[model samples]
Target chain A: MDMRAAVFRGPGEIAIEDVPKPALDAPTDAVVRVTHTAICGSDLWPYRGQEDRDVPSRIGHEPMGIVEEVGEEVRSVAPGDRVFAPFVTSCGECEFCRKGLHTSCVNGGFWGGEDGGAQGEYVRARHADGTLVRVPDRHADDEETLQAILPLTDVMGTGHHAAVSAGVDAGSTCIVVGDGAVGLCGVLAARRLGAERIIAMGHHEDRLALAESFGATDTIAARGEEAVERAQELTYGGANHVMECVGSTGAMNTAIEVCRPGGTVGYVGVPHGIEDDGLDIFGLFMDNISLNGGIAPVRAYADELLADVLGGTLDPSPIFTKTVDLDGVPEGYRAMDEREAIKVLVKP
Target chain B: MDMRAAVFRGPGEIAIEDVPKPALDAPTDAVVRVTHTAICGSDLWPYRGQEDRDVPSRIGHEPMGIVEEVGEEVRSVAPGDRVFAPFVTSCGECEFCRKGLHTSCVNGGFWGGEDGGAQGEYVRARHADGTLVRVPDRHADDEETLQAILPLTDVMGTGHHAAVSAGVDAGSTCIVVGDGAVGLCGVLAARRLGAERIIAMGHHEDRLALAESFGATDTIAARGEEAVERAQELTYGGANHVMECVGSTGAMNTAIEVCRPGGTVGYVGVPHGIEDDGLDIFGLFMDNISLNGGIAPVRAYADELLADVLGGTLDPSPIFTKTVDLDGVPEGYRAMDEREAIKVLVKP
Candidate 1:
């Protein structure tokens, strides 16, 4: 059988081409017919020629679909079930997975692993029982509800990880660096976690409005020292917690500078050009600050966020400012690259 | 009045010279007659020419003495009371002080601040009520008890800070990097906090033996990758907490590598030449490790440690392996610099 999927030819080049249809090759695997997918900020690393990539490789990780087939051993999910597959797959039984750090699961791997990617019409997901979360039958045909739940695969969960790592809770004063989709989600997570005050730093007036809507108490459209000064002024010194969602050196430094003594900075941006000399170890030590964070364990947070989505308590679909068909995946990447869209969703 | 004190003449040079005796200069100040003082690892930074110093400046911070005079506003201690001044002075009313982060107190200053240094016959102490802890009268005349209490001003307290910041508890498995006095003290601190297992990494057999005496369950006589491998082998993967008492880049890296996913690295070494690139941000983020710690809040930990000393529970005096009279102050620095003494006790 043949299927249509997005393939990466090189930097700035993505194409929808004919590819082999996915099949349940293992007893723990399930094949899902792709229904919706979204572009991520992380995808830009290779799209912008910043990271090397192998030509003709499968692309994309976030996807929601209807399971078309399941191996005999797959007991939790079956054909005809609507579901969301997190960016990473996990076995659900490893020490790390059992501890709720599914990203570090010993036997788990990324979606585009050897077989194919999620941008295709069908995806073969391994560790099926542990990797896929079932969508309610009530929302099976609701496009808006599906769009709202799609981001839980990566962005929403990543933001929640940042908040959790920084120890954000009731009465916490927080500063979020970056105004991207993930940064906006961070504002939502901080509010959900009961932060007393949240200051978001971003340059886009439009995104600043979105951030305020998502629960940011204040916004600073500045960078570097000016941003630090504005955040400090708002918090009366510096915030007790900071979320760094942009991986640039300046963004990391500004995040550190705006945190109070004995505070924590939770960083989630995938490091690309980060260098050792760009960090201020002496300053961090002198101020007694903690630097904590890593890749989000999206699989661990999926079910909880899906609950919020199904309960109608959260609506993250606004992040999808643009929509495209599978054939427009190339233009979707370009739109995100040019900052013309916060995020792009695709209906296959 | 004239009093003899240790004065820094230049790199690698020290002298016992006559300086003006200290007097109460502010309502919150007190004058202390020096009884016992000790050298610190930080002092070696300047003494070894690794860092610049202002020549003719008084040298020394860790000191225990008898309060000879107090300003009318000082209500905590009066004339003739035995006391020890924390290395850092803090205004009790500052937000940081109220949070028990006295090291970062808004109105705080180090020991050698306008007043003459602690290695003198009499020294002026600012914020006396907040920085000076009273010694019980029963142990006032015991020289051995006084020696044990002196380290509470810096080294012992710094080690305690490392343990606390790393969340060390009864069942935690830990690692202590560095074999100097501070590292040895870290072993003691971890054990005091009820850590189940502690692996101390050091190069010297003698220091390793001291680490064992201080409660290290295992010792790795290796450095760098080898040290990390050994620690991993012992802990199955990595330790729950790591104490980095050496400020070198390699020591910090080794500490980070030997910590388990989700563990904390408590670093208290005064960073000298650490750079940003030396850290593995991608790896740290992926593993969810936290880098926490800074200068010890000596004032905050002083009273509790003093209780241990008076109750005959902790004996940190073995760290003071060599003793020097007031006139031999210069030799004390030489002994510590040459590694001929673990620490030097100065008696005036």
Candidate 2:
């Protein structure tokens, strides 16, 4: 069967084109008819040619949809069930997956990088039982709720991972370094996790406002040393937990500088400019700071975050400042790249 | 009163000379008449001229001795008490000290770097209640026990810090990246923490044997990729906890390469060659590994470690392969720098 999907032709080029609908390739697979999807900061990496890719490939990994078909072995999810698919697909039974580090699952792979992308009208999900979370009945028919849920696939989950990895908990003083959707999401996550003081550092006033609304106790519209100085002044010395959501070297350094001695920097930005050099080992060692983080195990955190979403306590949809259909995804990418929108959502 | 002490004349130079005996400088200070002290691997930094120093400075930080006098405010210790002083002096009431991170205490200072060194007839200890741990009665009168206890002030405690910072616990597979005294002590610390398998990597057979004696289950006398390969082969992939006890770039890289995805590298070797270049941040981020550690908070761990020593469960004295009087310290530094001794004990 034919379906409409977003295809990446090259850097700065994406087109909605006719594609073959995905079918259940294995007994553990399920095909979902995408209802909503969104653009991610990571999607811009390949779009901007920062990350190399094969041309004319499927694009996008953040999608919420209704299961259209399931193989005989798929017992937990079935046709007509509304669900959220994590960016990474996992087998659920590997040592890493069983330990709740689904991102490191032995048999896991990314939605677009290793398999078919989720921007299509219908996409096949492998390890269906372990990769998809069912949407509750109360929010099943609500488009806004579904739009908010879309980000949990990658951005929100990733931000949550950053906060948790940095040890942001009750009484923690945290500073998030970035003004993007994920950074805003991180502010929300830190608040949810009970951080006592949340400092959001960014240049854009609009995004900073969004951050404050999402529970940032303070905002510093500065970069580099000034941002670090502001954070240090706000926290008396430096924050106990720092979240680096921008992959730039300066942002990473700022995160490190603004962290208190014995603090942790949880980095979730897909690193781009840090190939030739690493962080200052001597400085980090002298401060007794810890550097930790990676791609979020979204599958592991989806259920708990979903509880907060369904409970009506979280409304992350405000991050979707722009909306587009499958055909307008090209413009959606441009809007995000140009900083005109924090995130863009698509209704297929 | 005049007393003899070792003084650093310049790089690669030391001399025994008469100096005024230390007097209590603060209300919380105590004067220790040096009975036993040891040279540290860190001491070689200046002795070998790798590190610059101000001429004519006292030069040591690891010492244990009889408490000759205590300031009026000192409550926990008094004259005649035998104690082990940590390398860092901290005010017990500071936030960092109260949190058990004495090394980062607001009013903390390095014994040798910021104050008078320990290889002297008498040394003043600030914040005595927080920086010094009293030696048990049975071990106080025994010179052999005192020699064993001396290492806990720095080398052994630093190694223990590496293990703990790397999250070494029961059943963990660990690797120690150097075979120096501190690395050998790391093997002991890992074993004490219940690590299932301890791999000690180095080129020296003598130090490797000592590592095995200290509880290393495996030893790899190789460097770089060969070291990583051997570690991978033993752990089936990579070690869960890696203790980086060598500050060399090659050893640090090997430590990073041999760590399992999601594992940690606890580095305690005062970083030297890593100033211009850092670790591979992209690689570390992708692998989900964490880097943590710093100078050991010996004061925090000294009491617990001393219990193991007095209980006869640990004997770290073998690390002191040579002994010298105060006048022989210059030769002791030369012996250590020339690789003739693992560590040197100084009887003042």
Cα RMSD to native, each candidate?
2.0, 2.8
Cα lDDT tens digits for candidate 2, B79-114: 999988888888888888877788889887887533
Give the DockQ of candidate 1. 0.63
Q: Which candidate ranks first by DockQ, i.e. highest?
A: 1
Docking quality category of candidate 2 according to DockQ thresholds? medium
Candidate 1 per-residue C-alpha lDDT over B241-271 given as tens digits, one digit per residue, 9 for 90 to 100: 9999888777887888888887889999888
Those runs of model 1 whose alpha carbons end farther than 4 Å from true positions after fitting are A52-56
lDDT of each: 0.87, 0.86
